[model samples]
Target chain A: DAGITQSPRYKITETGRQVTLMCHQTWSHSYMFWYRQDLGHGLRLIYYSAAADITDKGEVPDGYVVSRSKTENFPLTLESATRSQTSVYFCASSESFHSYNEQFFGPGTRLTVL
Target chain B: AQTVTQSQPEMSVQEAETVTLSCTYDTSESDYYLFWYKQPPSRQMILVIRQEAYKQQNATENRFSVNFQKAAKSFSLKISDSQLGDAAMYFCAYRRRVNTNAGKSTFGDGTTLTVKP
Candidate 1:
């Protein structure tokens, strides 16, 4: 009954439009992350939050914004969605930022920007 | 920055057969962690198995096992008695040790595994 969830499993928007992918975890984990899955390239981190109000950029963060107002939620927003940004977005959470701890992933959101 | 590499883009094995997926990484850090994550067609990232750099014994989970060669910097996943459910995209990942900045995961391109019935 308790696990990470992502909303709007599928989304479609026009170029230059704004879109947000939501991620929520019930475990109240201290660390949350957003990653985009591109073909041929595994998963690239977009952003990660260590705790509420504490966030940092990951490998690919140029076109994204993240805010952790609450410990359970870390949402990613694409200010101006481009076709290049049209990819499946995955949300993950971990107890600690340390590597030993495994990350739990959400179902993922498939975004399409026309 | 550390990098993960999965040279095999695709591989296949018959049911009940054994297969190995290759992964190599480059990292200057001595203490770290290595992981094998499986993504089925459902797209959920499942933790297959994990190995700590400090451990000499390899990690195993039922039908899954890993051959980790630290000096050669190679980690490969060996699945015995493969099943149809084993069909998925397998990714090799690395994470730096604690007390290090940028506590994030670096993943390889991924190897697509197909199970032949």
Candidate 2:
């Protein structure tokens, strides 16, 4: 596919275990984001990157870590997964931060922490 | 900080009928964007429509349209001639125009739409 993609469509992890979710995009977009979708919260951004090696925290970024060493890749890691971290993770990218450019989202990764 | 709110948790529409999902947002930035995303059972987030804050004309895409009230801080999505494929979770989101902060979107809780044939 030419759009963004997330690996491990579904994942199962234990509490206190470390897990990393990988995101890749073929568009070479300038901005990429990581968000988690829960039942009542919709999608909350965990982190976002402006370009390679430039990342920033979002609304919920306490236990999560993200790095963008390349424009085509942005991986989010959970140092110590918790039960509350169980949710659907989505990766998105855009050509720029401008309002005119819409963000393209991936199929999402369903992560379950037991 | 920006916050998006979708008040209706669930909605139902009969085939060929129309349904509107309401969304409201709070933001201090004057120039920004509003978007409606549809997530079907497949869990892929698809952009349904988008509206720029500065544009006076509403945005429409096929059977999907939006009523953007900038002064009221509201953006609602309307789906006409509803089809079974239209049944999905609809989310409203807000984003800024500038690239200084990466333009992260703030999403609403989402409205689940059910189309009855």
**Candidate with best TM-score:** 1
Write candidate 2's Cα lDDT for B1-117 as tens digits.
998989999999999999999999999989988999899999988989998899999999999999999999999999999999999999998988776765578889999999999
Q: Model 2 reaches what TM-score against the true structure?
A: 0.96
Model 1 over residues B22-113: C-alpha lDDT tens digits? 99999998888999999999999999999999898999999999999999899999999999999999999998877444348899999999
| Candidate 2 error regions (>4 Å) | none
Residue-level lDDT of model 2, residues A1-114, one tens digit each, is 898999989999999999999999999999999999996668998999989998899899999999988899999999999999999999999898775687889999999999
Off by over 4 Å in 1: B100-103
With a 3 Å backbone cut-off (N, CA, C), the pairs that clash in candidate 2 are none
Give the least accurate 10-residue stretch of model 2 chain A, judged by summed lDDT: A94-103
- Cα TM-score per model: 0.97, 0.96
lDDT of 1 by residue, A1-114 (tens): 599999989999999999989999999999898999987779999898889999998999998999999999998999999999989999999987676888999999999899
